[model samples]
Structure formats: C-alpha cells, structure tokens
Target: MSARAALATALDRIERYDEDIGALLEVDAAGAAARAAELDRSESHGALHGMPFVVKANMCIEGRIASCGSRMLEGYRAPYTASAVQRLIDEGAVPIGIANMDEFAFGSSGENSSFGSTRNPWDLSRAPGGSSSGSAAAVAARMVPFALGSDTGGSVRQPAALCGVTGYKPTYGVVSRHGLIAFGSSLDAVGVLATSAADVERVLAVISGADERDATSALRAPFEPAPARTDLRGLRVGLPREYFPADLDGRVRQPLEQALDDLRRLGAELVELDLPTTRHAIAAYYVVATAEASSNLARYDGVRYGARIAGDGSLQGMFAATRGAAFGAEALRRILLGTYVLSSGYYDAWYLRALKVRRAILRDFQAAFERVDVLAAPTSPTPAFRLGEKLSDPLAMYLCDVLTVPTSLAGLPAISVPCGCAAEDGVELPVGLQLIGPAFEDARVLSVARCYQAATEHHRRLPPLVAGGVA
Candidate 1:
C-alpha cells in the first residue's frame, strides 16, 4: 500500500477507536498525510518507505508537543527532533502522533501518565504496562504499524509483553540518545515497538548507527541479520531459578514453562543458572535510576525550556513555581527521592552503594552469559493488571519490573515476545517470555524472539479492539 493510504487507515482507526484506548496524546493526521505525500514520489525510498508510526511522547519531534505525559510540559513543543526520530523520518517513516507514557517515564503502570492511563486493548480495565504504555497499546490496537519507545528499566519490554507485541531495547549507546528526554541516562535506550521481529529489525537497521551529536553513540557496526531458522542445535538457553518465585501465579508460570519446553523441543540446550544478586536488582535499579533522573531533570528549571510559571518577581520564585505547577505527584516523588539520594552527605551512602550493586548485577549477567547463549525468563510475573491496581503502592509497582531490570543494568539487549496467556478470573491475560542477549548482540535477541514467535501464534493474537471491537 502507498504511504498515504496506510496513514489514512491509521488516522481512521485513531478517530474510530482511540477514545476508548487513550493510546495517543496527540495525533497529527494532517501532518502525517503531508509527509506521506512527500515520500510517495521520492526516487529512493529508505527502509521505512512511507511507513507510519508513533513516538513515545518523551522523544522530541520538531514543532510537536513533546509532553512527557506530565503537567510540567503539558503544552511544551520541541525545538528540534530527537536523533532517533529524525533517523526514522529520514528513512521515509512518517510520525503519525505522540503516544502517552508514565509521567516523566517514572511509573511501571500506564496509570501514572498525567494525561490518563492507556488501557490494555485486550481488557479495557487492565493496564498496558508502562512507561511505554501508549507505544505498546498503539501497536497492539493497530493504530500504527510500529512505534518508538525508550527503556530506562523495563519501560519498553514490560509493556510489549503485556500488550502481546514485540518490544526490543538495544544495548545502551547503540542508538543515539541526543533528543530523548532523560530518565536514567546510563541505562536508557531507544527501543522499537512493532507487530513482529522483522519490523523491529528493519527499523533498528536504519537507526542503529553512531552519531557525532551523541557522545555516547557506539562506533558503527555492520548490520547483519540473524539466521532465520530456529534450529538452535548448539544454542544454550539459560533459565535463572530466581525468576520463578513461589508467589508467581500459576497462570503465568504454566505458559512460561510451556515456552521453555517448546525451546527444548527446538533443540535449545536448557541450562540452570543462578543470579544471586537478582534479589537486590529492584532496590538497586530504583536508587540508580532516580539518582540519574535527579541529575538529568535538574535542567528543567523554567529558565530554558518547558512550562514556565507566570508573574515571577525573582528567578528562584519562577523556578519553584514552574516545577511546582508543572510536575505531577509521581514526578515530584521521583524528584524528591532522586535529590535525597544524591544529596551531599547521603550520596556516598545511597547513590554510591547503588552503583556498587549495579556493578554486581552486571557481573552476574556476565557470568551467566558465559554458560548460555541467551537467558530466558518471564517478562513480567503476571500479565496486565487493572489500571489502578498497583498505583497506591509504589513498591508493588516497582516489583512488577523484577525480571526485566537485571538486563537493563547490564546494558544488554533484550526482547519481549508473547508466549501465551494466563488463565485467571475466567479470562486469559497475555504472558511474555523475555530473552536477554550479550551486549551488542541485538541480532541474537531478535533471532530468538522471531524463532519463538514463529513457533507459536501467541504474538499473532490481536487485542479485542483490533480483532473485533470495543464491546
């Protein structure tokens, strides 16, 4: 289909179905049409020729409102596009809109988004896990064929799992971070959310090179696609004993075990691995992420960009008012926690210790990778929960990331693909199995994901809104 036609279809779906899903924070139907028209006649179409996609609200797209789903930047417009977004546009992909996310990408559940939560299209009352909530939901709803998301922790992978889509987070520094509004700089990575592994691989191919603009960008590496077949004759898949806790629901465990069985049948050698430091990953992740957030977010002081408070008699007053009014309760909570962790005397005790723990976690992954080609675990302990189910308890929200955080800390590549569904309350919630690869081994991660996806039709199931309609 032509780019214009694809965009029209996306816009029609947005108009017809977005109201109930809340997947989009902004939809530029006209803008997208114009871009598609421009690409339609280009002599040399790039990899994403005339493709339409959504970007997480946090990533800047020139002239568009780049609200990070927070009151602070509710009406903020981007002065320039993020390098990742720009790369997509250059490749002939048109940005259809910006999707909702957890405020400042701080929450694990979509409910934390100040614009309102993005509903899991599978079950409206359930969350489309966040802070890549809208990115995952939009793809699941078929509002767009693919979308861009950022992962500081499990922001992209967790949501992709819950929404039954493919979410791939590249190794840190593999993708340019020049325009991604910071959450945890060291851990953050630009990710892609799409319907299949091939789509992800295509998008990543175009945007995965070094950029002088981003000092952290990795040196360019040749794009080599993983072998298409899943004859993992010599591939060793590691299963960490810690990932399956006693408290794990049977609905989640059964499908996960079945997925492992399928891998075994496909000739993957299953090896039991121990990541003892996994117990401290959640606490360590929070401490490290918030500390980095404290530093990265300090720039939004009303003096430069974003929402500014009016009628300030002094500079301090302006800064205080702007942040006070712009930031939401959750963002404020993170800022406070971040500031406290990085504060003068406490930095050594809290922030420094977290760094030590982070190193330990990385070491654990390094050790395990020596014995296995890839590590497998349940992406999330349970499937999507009701919208407000865990919002009241911050720790509970943090716990949802247990299986995904260790990989983030290790700066390894990971992909989450739906394995099956969990039967609970007479309903089946999606279950995602996560595959973690060594640093710069994104191809392997994608390869394993595609293998599993081909072996099962789990990822092929569409959410109700896309398969049928809102009942």
Candidate 2:
C-alpha cells in the first residue's frame, strides 16, 4: 500500500477510536498527509518507504510538539529531531504525531501524564503500562505500524506487554539519545513498539548505528538484520527463579507456562538460573535513574525554555513557582527524591551505594549469560491493572517493573513478546514473555522472539478496540 493509503487508515482510526483510548497527545494528520503525498510522488526514497508511525512525546521531531507528557514544555517545538527518529524519517517512515507518556517518563502507570492517562486498548478501564503507554496502545489499536518510545526502566516493554505488542529496548547506546528529552540519562534508551518482533527488527536496523551528535552513541557498525529462525535449536533459555513469585496471579502464570512450553517445543533448553542481585535491581535502578533525571531536568528553569512563573520579582522565587506550577505531583516527587539521594551528605550513602548495586546487577547478568543465551521472565508483575488501581500507592506502582528493571540496570537488550491472554471478567488481558540478551546482542533477542512468534498466534491477536479483533 502507498504511504498515503496507510496514513489515511491511521488517521481514520485516530478519529474513530482515540476518544476512548487517549493514546495520542497530539495528532499531526496534516503534516503526515503532506509527507505521505511527497513520498508517493518520489521515484526513490528509502527502506520503510511510506510507513506511518508515532513517536512518544519525549522524542523530538523537528517542529513537532514534544511535551514529554509534562506541562512544563506544554507547547515546546523541538529545533532538531532526535537522532533515532530522524533516521526513521530518513528511511521513509512518516511520523503521525506524539504519543502520550507518563509525565517526564516518571511513572509506571500511564495515569501520571499531565495530559491524562492512556488507556489500554484491550480494556479501557485498565492502565496501559507506561511511560510508553501511548506507543504500545497505538500499535495495538493498529493506528500505526510502529511507535518510537524511550525506555528508562521497562517503559516500552511493560506497556507492550499490557497492550499485547512487541516492544524492544536495544543495548545501551545502540541508538543515539541526541534529541530524546532527558529522563534517567544512563538507563534511558530509545526503543521500538510494533506488532511483532520482525517488525521491530526492521525498524531497529534502520535506526541503530553510531551518531556523531551523541557522545554516548556506540561506535559500532550499522545493525544488520538477522535471518529468521524457525526453531531455537541449541538455544539456551534461562528462567530466573525471581521472575515467578509465589503470589503471581494464576491467570498470568498459566499463559507464561504455556509460552515456556512453546519455547521448549521449539528445541530451546530452558535452564533454571539464579541472579541474587535481582532483589536490589529496583532499589538501584530508582536511585540511579532519579539522580540522573534531577541533573538532566535542572536545565528547565524559567530563564530558558518551557513554562515560567514570574514570582515576587526574584530569581529563586520565580524558579520555585515555575517548577511548582509546571511539574506534576509525580515529577516533583521524583525530583525531590533524586535531589535527596544526590545531596552532599547522603550522596555516598544513597547514590554511591546505588551505583555499587548497579554494578552488582550488571555482574549478575554477566554470570547468567555464561550459562544461557537469553533470559525469560514476565515483563510486568501483573497484567494491566485498573487505571486508578495503584496511582495512590507509589510502591505498588514501582513493583510493577520488578521483572524488568534488572535488565535495564545491566544495560542489556530486551524485548517483550505477547505470550497469551489472562481471561478476566468479560475482558481478555494480554501477558508478555520477556526475552533478555547480553549487551549488544540485540539481533539474538529479536531472533528468539521471532522464532517464538512464528510458532504462536499471540502476536497476531489484536485488541478488542481494533476493528474485527476478538480481543
């Protein structure tokens, strides 16, 4: 199909369905339509020619609204596009709009967005795991073929799990962070959300490479697509004991067991492994992420870009007023916590210790890799919870990422593939089987996911909200 046709379909769905999903914060239908028309007229473009996709609010696309789900930059228009996104646009992927996210990518539930929560496509009452909520939801709803999301701590994978899509977080620095609005700099990674692991791999190949603009971008060769695997012969899959807690819901566990069985039937040897440092993953991740966030966000003062509150004609008062009015409750909470951890007296006790724990987590993954080619786990502690379910309880919300933060801390590659559904009261919620790989082994992760998807119909199932889908 032509880019114009694809875009028209997406725009039609956005109009017909967005009212219920709340996945998009802004829709650039006109801009995308123009781009699609030009691409159709052009004799030659690039790979992904005429593809329609959305970018999370945090990823800057030159001249597009990039609010990062916070009121602070409510109408901010980026001067330059993010490196990863620009690569997609260059490859002929047309960006339709900015997908909603947790405010400053701070929360696990999409409800934290200042713009409003992005509801799950499977069930409107349930939350779309965030802060990549809209990215996952949009793809699941079939509004777009793919979306660009930033995963600081399973933001992309967790949402994809809840929404039943393929979400991939590449090894750190595989994609440049040039124009991604800062949030947990070290842990933050530009990720992809698509219908399947194969689709995710296609997008990754185009965008994965070194960029001169980003100092942290790896000096590596362009990503080469991998051959599709029909079977996981000789593949060693590790099952971490921590990932399956005793309190896990049977509805979720049942589907997981089925997925593991599928892997085994595909010739994968599932090996039980132990990573003791998994217990400290959450604690270490929060500390490191918040500390970096505090430093990265400090630049959003009244004197520069974004919202400003001129208070009492004083610099300090204006700063406080501007921040207080612009930042949401969750953003403020993180800022305070981050600041406290980085403070002089407590830096060693909190921030430094977190760094030590981070190292330990990385080592743990290294040790596991010696015995297994990939690690499998639940992407989120539970299936998509009710929208307001854990909003009032931050601890409960944090635990949602318990199964994902360890990989983020280790800076390894991970992808969440839809396993199956957890049948509930008149609604079928999806569960995800997460595959983690050693650092820089993204292709392996994608290959395994593709093999699993080839053998299962999970990724083929569309959300109820999408037309003709059986949920």
Record all residue pairs in model 2 with backbone atoms less than 3 Å apart, i.e. clashing: none
Off by over 4 Å in 2: 469-471
Q: What would you estimate as the lDDT of candidate 2? A: 0.91
The sequence of per-residue lDDT tens digits that candidate 2 reaches over residues 1-471 is 899998988998888788999999889988999999999999997899988999999999999989999999998998989988889989999999899999999888899998999999999999989999999999999988899999999999999999999999999999999999989888889999999988998999999999999888999987776798889989999999988878887878999999999999999999999999898989998888889988888988888789999987799999989988899988888888899999999999999999999999999899999999999988987898998989998888888889889898888999999999998898999999999999999999999999999899999998877757322
Candidate 1: regions farther than 4 A off:
310-312, 469-471
Overall lDDT per candidate, in order of appearance: 0.88, 0.91
lDDT of 1 by residue, 1-471 (tens): 789988888898888778999999999888988889988887888888888999999999999979899887878999999998998999999999999999989887888888889999888889999999999999988888899999999999999999989899998888999889989999999999998888899899888889888898898773456879856678899999999777787878998999999999888999998999999999888889888887888888888777888647788888888888888877787889999999999999999998999899999999999999999999988899988889888889998899888889889999998888876676668888899998999898888878877887888888756687421
Which structure among the candidates has the greatest lDDT?
Answer: 2
In model 1, the clashing pairs are 72-326
Q: Model 1 clash tally?
A: 1
Model 1 misses residue 350 by how many Å? 0.9
lDDT measured at residue 73 in model 1 versus the true structure, 0 to 100: 84
* Clash count of each predicted structure: 1, 0
